[model samples]
Target: MKTILLHVSLVLCAVSSLQSRTWTEAQTGRKLEADFVKVQGDAVVVRAANGSTMQLPLARLSEADQTFVKEQAETATKPATTAAKTEEKSSGKEDAKKALIGTWDGYMADSDGSRHGDIRLVITEEKITASNPRGGQEMGAGTYKISGKRIDATGTEGQFRGKKYEGIFDLDSKTLKWCSANDNPNSSRPTQMQTNPQAGQFLMVLEKK
Candidate 1:
């Protein structure tokens, strides 16, 4: 959990770096060069070039800086609201339970982008039926839960039965990318869409069928 949090923090910092700019104090007109982190309550969090983070009250910033901070905050939140509404509408429900209920055809690829094997999946509200093909021999059965872009699944059949997996996924109307790591003994969930089979991470690119 801490790893995930740290990864997210790093990503946010990188984004802030790209948006680094000058901020002016309203009363003294003192200018500070910093990267905008986030707006907390009535204050804005910023990171200096020296890697120090500090919070300044919105009232202390110039009008233009305050406007910039509010705009940044709104821009950050709009996509989440839009995505939630889109998913709810597409699933024809208030949640994501049925959003992934369908047949998917894809191949598992190794770190070097070599296809290991072709696979098919039939997903329902809570269960996943995996196989080599649409009607070929069954590979495994599992139960999964989705929270935003993260998927938590546990195998319930075959050799992998009782094994837990954690992954991140990007799903749309046509394509889905599922990248995961086995969480049996010790493995961290993937933070990006890449695979390292030697490290127990895998990537699957699938298309709805």
Candidate 2:
């Protein structure tokens, strides 16, 4: 009986020692040896014996390492997360500015020496609408597709006209030139005249508004 009791105590001590030096994944409930874990600021940088490093949230660490890891995580995540957020914001701004969202003045001249006069284009998030100030008439709304520097607009041309025209508007120079190709179906001419088939192709020139 004495020998059996001693063996049981030895097993208990071994189990306790093992538990003290290990960590378990809170989400998946998987256990990992503690010696393989390293505490790097706000991030718990873990390096396995095999030499692979994985960074995790500091909160995921054990209580004993929490204090030190929390501080490190804060410092490390701040700059990294802030930089990631800044990059996302910059990407969004570029996307919004890629299209001609504001108002634009446009003119189209036909091959017959007749000009269609000046027109105002107002593009909103939902649709692209245009109007002719001379007649105070709405040109109806249509959908548009804008690429890096090219714009293809298609919309209603009012009661007497059809609603489809593909043109390229270059926003860099604030110049817009498009043609009414829907009216003349047989004409193979380019829809609008511009230096490039792209929009936003001109050099960026900005002044304080």
**Top lDDT hit:** 1
Error of 2 at 161 (Å): 9.7
Residue 121 lDDT (model 1): 83
Q: Which lDDT tens digits does candidate 1 get at residues 56-170?
A: 7777778788667655655665676899888776664425556678999999987877777899988998788888884698988899978778888899997558988899988
What lDDT tens digits, residue by residue, belong to model 2 across residues 63-138? 5445433333354446667899889977765665554467765554434434546566677755677677568678
lDDT, model 2 = 0.47
Each prediction's TM-score against the native? 0.53, 0.40
**How many residue pairs clash (N, CA or C atoms closer than 3 angstroms) in each of the candidate models, in the order given?**
0, 7
C-alpha lDDT of all candidate models, in order: 0.77, 0.47
Q: Which lDDT value does model 1 have at 96?
A: 57
Cα error, candidate 1, residue 34 (Å):
54
